[model samples]
Target: MFARVVVTNMGNEMFNDGLFYTEQAELHKDQQFNKWRYCRSAIICFCVAAEAELAKLIAHSLRKQPHLSPEYTEILLFLTDPNSDKPIPKKLKNIRKKYNLLRRLNGLRPQKPDQRYMELTELRNKIIHYTFSSHEDVYAGTILDSTKIARDAVRDFIADLYSIVRETPPEWVNNNSSIDIQ
Candidate 1:
């Protein structure tokens, strides 16, 4: 029997929402209106969703290992804050650190977040903390580029995990295509 892992759908939903916002922004731009506001928010939403999806994948994969199950449970508890007292942000940071450590122990190279992933994260932070005068100032093109990078990173990470779960390289790995959730 094949082991089944339930993947979260939130990432796909958020990505779709981001696309909708991008389309709206484009429409506004064509109509000679400011598009940056929506575009910036869209990118941030997409990044957040993608990160959630990636974290889910990592946690799911790690939990499958009998030896790591205990650690996985702790991480989940930290993330959920069942105690209702732990700072969620700090717990989230610790979870990311632990995830990286597990990735390294699993023999995956580039255990840390990918360069593009890190860049998108930083961009998301800047957008959230600072203000831009115009959509042009934020460089809509750059946001679009970061979106592609973020998507590719998620795809690659999923592909790698799928390969491990199947004990072989899945067809998507060779084809450079998205994994079919079925």
Candidate 2:
């Protein structure tokens, strides 16, 4: 008898959404209208997809360690969250913490988040916490550049995680090719 496994669709769906936003940003990269919007959205979606996938990986790893006591498991689940008073189910960890936990669970060596991950995270934060006044230039090309960085970051992040887990990444991660944005 073969073991049957069922997985949720949200992680992939979010990744695909990021791809869609990337496409939109590319299509409008040369235009002034909505290009910044699309680029910003693409960066945000990519970051979200990366975080969602990491969370899913941690959750799956948690499932494999059935020997852990319920209290210990809860502690592991919320390890990144500082507020211990919060309900276990409601606590959430930031992406870097989640990655660290995943590494610890797999007996991997500890390291800081890599450059690609930091670059993507910074891009996501820059756009997400938008300010009204800034000396930074606001243009379609500039925003599109950030979008491309985000696209590569998420792809690399996913590939690296899959490699750590000894699993093959999905087709989309490898299939991304540069298309003419104009």
lDDT of 1 by residue, 85-115 (tens): 6444333473346446446546665356556
Q: Write the per-residue lDDT of candidate 2 for residues 1-182, one digit (tens) a residue.
A: 89988765554666666777778878877775678778777777778777777776776666777576665478556644556565744224455666776776677875676688777787677666756542153443577777777777788898877776668877766545433222
* Candidate 1 structure, TM-score to reference: 0.61
Error of 1 at 74 (Å): 2.0
Name every residue pair that clashes in candidate 2. none
Cα TM-score of candidate 2: 0.75
In order of appearance, the predictions have TM-scores of 0.61, 0.75
Model 2 lowest lDDT segment of ten: 173-182
Error of 1 at 122 (Å): 1.2
Worst 10 residues of 1 by lDDT: 169-178
RMSD of each: 7.1, 6.7
> Candidate 1: which pairs clash?
none
- How high is the lDDT of residue 25 in model 1? 63
